[model samples]
Target: MGWLDRLLGRRRPRPIPPPLWQQTVARLPFLQWLPAADLARLQSLSEAFLAAKQFSGAAGLEVDDAMGVHIAAQGCLPILNLGLEWYDDWVEIIVYPDEFVVPRQEMDPDGVVHEYDEVAAGQAWDGGPLILSWQDSQMAGDGYNVVIHEFAHKLDMINGAPDGLPPLHPGMDREAWVAALDGAYDDFLARVERAEARGEEALEQLPIDPYGAEHPGEFFAVVSESFFEQPQVVAAEYPALYAQLALFYRQDPLARAQAAGSSRSR
Candidate 1:
């Protein structure tokens, strides 16, 4: 920032120290596939995210700067193309030592209400804090990243309830996105039903995580995680939905990963 801007109290973001940043990126292999420009942008977004949000650790866990930076790096990856303003609705991130149980209540279509405790690795509440299990967050890079999953939920909830649909940019075909996602969702559900009839082992053969078939909102999150962590699997198994996600995210992870691999060979 210039002197004049400083005089006006327009504080600039502090640069993320190289050592801290290198440590964070070293642990996240998926980030290695990002192009230099995109990697730099993700770094900037992660710094901004760290500056804007508050982090708290639960169950006797202490959230140090390293842990915070690591979490922020993964959290900011989804918005690498999209801006940080999309996450302005929430400012707090709560991390648990392990899986946490949340009390949930729901009303059935028949007008009956039910209550239960849901075990979750991560969760995002509309207009509220985003929660995660640090244990699950560390298990990223195996085609499942809870940080990305919860952040995806936040994105899905930006317009309204997260029913698997997030607000699309101008010129994006809403009908096309719906058809692709809904069609895949229905097909996956049918497959799961058939697998149940066959055996549990059959259900384990699903391309995408079986949890995705739980609901539309989860389908979006699960696929979003797969798009970043296992793009090839997602692209191959659900090309149409992958294309829709590629359009929405404005990045192609499969292409990026291939390019990264080619560069490594050189």
Candidate 2:
């Protein structure tokens, strides 16, 4: 057994408290939109996640049961259909009270190296601990989910370097995945450039995060945030990409939202 398994006192996970599970689900509407069976599965997966990982609070922030469960709930959504084993390679999650700055150094084409601090809400290191800003993690609505965004990066890193493509499941086409993400990435990059030229209004009007234009990997993570929180927007703006994501995730969130809406209307 692994250290985590020993720490938890068993190989299996203990259940999350009923009230905490309900409260957590209520806070995340995308999770609440799930069918009862799926939601239960997610809860189970989250319990396993909590058992397998260790969470630490940085900047003097205290990590509590509620905070842990909340983060676990959101983080486990992407792997609800896939298993917790996808995340087994990493064991630590570090949380900050708010945005944290990381020093960065980059070399230009001319070989000039520059150093600066970059403020980030969340970060997933390749084969290392995932980091998050609790303040940003609370901003889960409107396609700005830091928890899901970072978890998606964790998924992307599973194969090797994150380049907008992770290891596809059996029978999934690599060329098709490339085509879908590449086509959308190119178009989105152009749109962001155009919007930047116009002003803040155009940038704010973007259906998805303009930061996605930073790189193909960032595009995958950003659109993944949209895929869960704002599925309809993804479905409408990039149907082909949405289809690919659904195939990969094995969950059709847009369809779930539509069905939930219809049920509520009845």
Candidate 3:
């Protein structure tokens, strides 16, 4: 049994076949960018994650070994250095065939309630199961990763609420974390507003996702996706925030990407 199986008192998950693992890694460029040692570590972490969580498919979809392995690989990346125990609170992962509708109700300032349906590609519930659209989960390499985005929210919720702040490490500065993310959040919100005023053309040019402006929590999740999938954009656009994330996640994706690029050039 793996460490997670022993810790959780669950049966050990079957190991991912070597050919399948290679095929899945080949399809994800960000995973391809990982150093050999880190890639091996990620595989081990993914196995533990699979052993610990239950996966169910919704809307007539079927969850297969390949699908489970793919999701586990991406989902475990953030916790690679942090450890599997960070995700011990949650046990179920629900996946839809495509974007799913969630019924939402809200009360306005005048105490009137409004109800509507919101379509989402992925969602991470507080102390509950994580949900995803299989279609969106497949779109990982270009920075719009629903798996990473939702998993990042899970990390944020580990402490209390998902308010763009996860519990910092012993040496990490909470004040600095707030300053960096808040400053970038404000700036990005302004940029998004301007893009909305100008039109869709301007919005499409944004290096980061405009949905990040929705909330600080959302910003943290969106940037976390970029941090792993497109580290160059985060490192170049928000150096301070990127540094904070590196410190929090305990991995330097930018350094890895740069090393890979230099290797390719040589």
Ranked by lDDT, the better of candidates 1 and 3 is 3
Reference-based lDDT, each prediction: 0.87, 0.91, 0.91
Model 3 vs. true fold: TM: 0.95
> How well is each residue in 119-148 modelled by candidate 2, as lDDT tens digits?
999999999999999999998977999999
Highest TM-score: which candidate? 2
Backbone clashes, each candidate: 0, 0, 0
Off by more than 4 A, model 2 = 1-11
The superposed Cα distance between candidate 1 and the true structure at residue 178, in angstroms, equals: 0.5
Which tens-of-lDDT digit does each residue in 159-181 have in candidate 3?
A: 98888999899999999999999
Clashing pairs in 1: none
Rate residue 234 of model 2 by lDDT: 92
- Pairs clashing in candidate 2? none
Task: Please give the lDDT score at residue 141 for candidate 3.
Answer: 96
